[model samples]
Target: MMKTTSIIASLLILSATTFAQSWTVDKVHSRLGYGVTHMGISESEGSFKDYTAKITSSKEDFSDAVVELTANVASINTENEQRDGHLKSPDFFDAAKYPTLTFKSTSFKKVGDKQYKVTGDLTLHGVTKPVTLDVVLNGTTTNPMSKKTVAGFKITGTIKRADFGVAAGMPTAMLGDEVAIRANTEFIKD
Candidate 1:
């Protein structure tokens, strides 16, 4: 009985260690973007040029994971230099003061086979609010060159600029309050 107990305990420890893992974001294959309606007639799209994401999980399927991301507000690009500058000014993100926008996942719930509902606190313009994102686990594979496990995910969500105190000169009639957020991220197991 004693020998059997020792064997079971060793197996349990190995299983626990095998399940827990850490992943590092591969910026080369990741993109974070946002879109907003302009003048209720057109839509403008932009992307952040600098960001980082770290994820930790213990589940084999990544059902239990903690995710954190941060983006540089000053790196906002909208294809137009002038507009991009304006977005970084005090009227919008106030990049000079709050230079970084961050998100930290509080909970992750599996809604489908590869779909998840991720609820987290998003901090923008110095204000934090709860946001839920629909996330899809694209897939996981082993990198041929790096010999590391890689995973891909697509996430989508929406947030109100006014809620985060980002409504400076952006009036409702001129600019939409809701901003659509989308991200395609790849991670390498570390």
Candidate 2:
């Protein structure tokens, strides 16, 4: 009877694994971006040129998924030349000092059929902090261009820029200490 029970347990575990869906970001349709108040009247927009993301989800539920992201700090892009240079300098991101920004999932809970609250540790500019993202699972579909099954999601939230050791000069009249960030990505099965 013990041997029979062990065999049944093994079968259940295998079945659970088989039903899970795992995917990696499809760079062509994925985007990582952020917006910050500039001069208190305007907003500054920027995005990282290089990033990698992965998702391991169970088609059965949103709570049964893991999300991860890694971004290259040097990939920061804003339109201007001088400002971008300054941002990359020691006064701000100091990309030379910290080359990568990473995030690993700590929890993923469902808020709706396609909405989720994802909490994780975000490490940026040499600082690590917990952050929560309001994520919307845009559902899954087949991409004609890539000829692959893909899942899309829109993840957004804000983090205190200062908390990430990115606090430089925040001119209240121009820019503030808080920054708004948004990331949208589509993951494809590997």
For each candidate in the order shown, give its overall lDDT on alpha carbons: 0.92, 0.85
lDDT of 2 by residue, 1-190 (tens): 9999999999999988888888898888878999989877888998988999988876546587888889998888897778888888888899999989999999999988889999999999988999998999888888888788887889899988878868457555666777777888888887
Clashes of each: 0, 3
Reference-based lDDT, residue 103, model 1? 94
Assess candidate 2 and give its TM-score to the true structure. 0.91
Each model's TM-score?
0.90, 0.91
| RMSD, one per candidate, in order | 3.2, 1.8
- Candidate 1 wrongly placed segments (more than 4 Å): 1-18
